[model samples]
Target: MPEMGRLPAGTMGLAFEEAIRRLELRNRLAALFERWGYLPAATPIVDFYDVYREWVNPQHVYRFTDREGDLVVLRSDATLFLARLLGLQLSEISQPLRLWYAEETISHIPSNHPVGDTGFQAGAEYIGLPQGEADWEVIILASEALECLGLQDYRIHLGSRALARVLIEAEGQTWSKDLIRDIHRLSGPCWENLSANLRHQFQCIGEPDQIAQQLGPFASCPEAAFLLQSCDILRSAGLGERLVIDLNEVGLLSYYTGLVFKIYVPGYHEAVVSGGRYDGLLKKFGIEAPSVGFSLQQGLIEVLHGSPEPQAPPAAASGTSWLERLANARRRRAKGERVVL
Candidate 1:
């Protein structure tokens, strides 16, 4: 055999069964969205680097200069692309046009290991949607997507960009950036041990100093009373239990004007589902519409909770890839179901 081998970028070349399961997940989600009037669309894996950089990060993208001396590269995330396309191409599609898609995304993972990560994502953007309805739709879609993936034992952790900003402003300061970064790193349990005041502020009870040591400058947002009042408005319109408000929680996406959420599963370290409202993005493409959306981190979820998919015998590979067929077949045989490849 060759000393070592490397797969091509932008693809893993999966076999049929694994592809089927993924396609099933995508199809189910698309169908659900379609039933709600959200139309499905496709996006490219490459685009002008300027837009990507101005939107996400300038350096993280796999960038290069084209023959025309324009910066362009593989698009790591298609959210911006979709937004741009809709603003330019579908301006006549009526207000609040619902768009959903499942696609591969490339993004720079800025963490301890500093990885360049690529994975699958399914998301929907509601054009011209109002804050109240848009927020509710995103939360419901997130939960529904989990159900589509054959997963349970997860809860939607909700917060509002509007709420977090209000709390940060209420803390009697400009809100230190360093402090903001610190608070984000603390895990749940560690946030539970501090003094009652701090605990209430953190919305958790953990070693404050220890937690701070890990996550950084922390601010308190015990203004749940205020959030409850606002939440009442949403509840009056009917979506209280599906939503949770912790005045203390802050989010990373700067464009979020209101309402943000993360879906957590028992085993995954990162949020398996994440999204929020970005009312300002439409203006970036030179039109005016409020937008809200979220994407499912399918691959990471599978990595944490899914076994290596099975593959099949060689001859049957003619029709299509059966990467996980063998693995699934053996599992069935182990359970005394005879299958021949």
Candidate 2:
């Protein structure tokens, strides 16, 4: 075994410096949300497993047994919970509930993680709204948030789960619930390498050809002519070049039923932010309302941005200039600048 060192892997003296920069960025993010008229809200760290389960992927939520032996999960995602909230509060408000939140959420998605099962997330959701206006507003907010953070060279990738659903439902196919999930999840090489997962799920379902036909047009962004013929949702909610359509991007299976997307930094493998419209999500709460929302990956963003840390020297040793330095420190303190001990 090796002798102990000063810091652990994924932990370091630099992380402290990184945290300060992220904290500053967080404050700016909040101001943007406020200006957009999306009031802030917070959900509990631990919440009803069923509430989260109904709209969050099983792999994403961290489940455990409490001391009382009851099953509970740390809240994995905030958008779904907010959807449920708007449903219950529907009568209290009018159409298109606009709300935003800047809070930490827990995600077990990453395989190798350190102590923090937690992630700092900030996002907004619009409820009781349909595709056009509701979605555009969220997209604009996403763009603004990135601009506020001074991020450029990012693109918003768009797709519709409706196309995926339409494909599965088209052939009058009767796939098991889980198969529908896999087909919606696996893509490209994974879909081929992991066809085994889909085999059993496809057993009760019909031949594969029927499935391909509905998925054909969507496999690539629907042809321009086809997109022009899309429903009001896609019609009024036109996607631009920066906001591209992949048709195959089946994101967030647990909640989204249509119009899913993610914002990708030019070089990163995973999206910086991903979300979509889960109009049916609120129905599980006994209210039928359309909703859309997304969550930002704070840690990932910090990594990409290489957020700088404060690098103040330790208090200077006593010297002829010590008095002058002390006076300077006092002046900085008066203006709210920190004085490192």
The lDDT for every candidate, in the order shown, is: 0.63, 0.63
Task: Quote the positional error of residue 48 for candidate 2 in Å.
Answer: 2.5
Compose the digit string of candidate 1's lDDT tens values, residues 188-286.
433333334443554532232333332233323333333344345544544445445543445555566777777777766777888878888778877
TM values, all candidates: 0.72, 0.72
lDDT of 2 at 199: 34
Per-residue lDDT of model 2, residues 1-341, tens digit only: 35475443333333566767777778888899888887787766776676666556677677887888877887767776666566566644456667777666776655475324566778888777877667767876887787788787777766556665554455454434464455555543434433342332322222223333434454354422232233223324543345554544556555677667688887666688887788777777777778888778766777777647467854533335868767777776777776532
Which candidate leads the pack in lDDT? 1
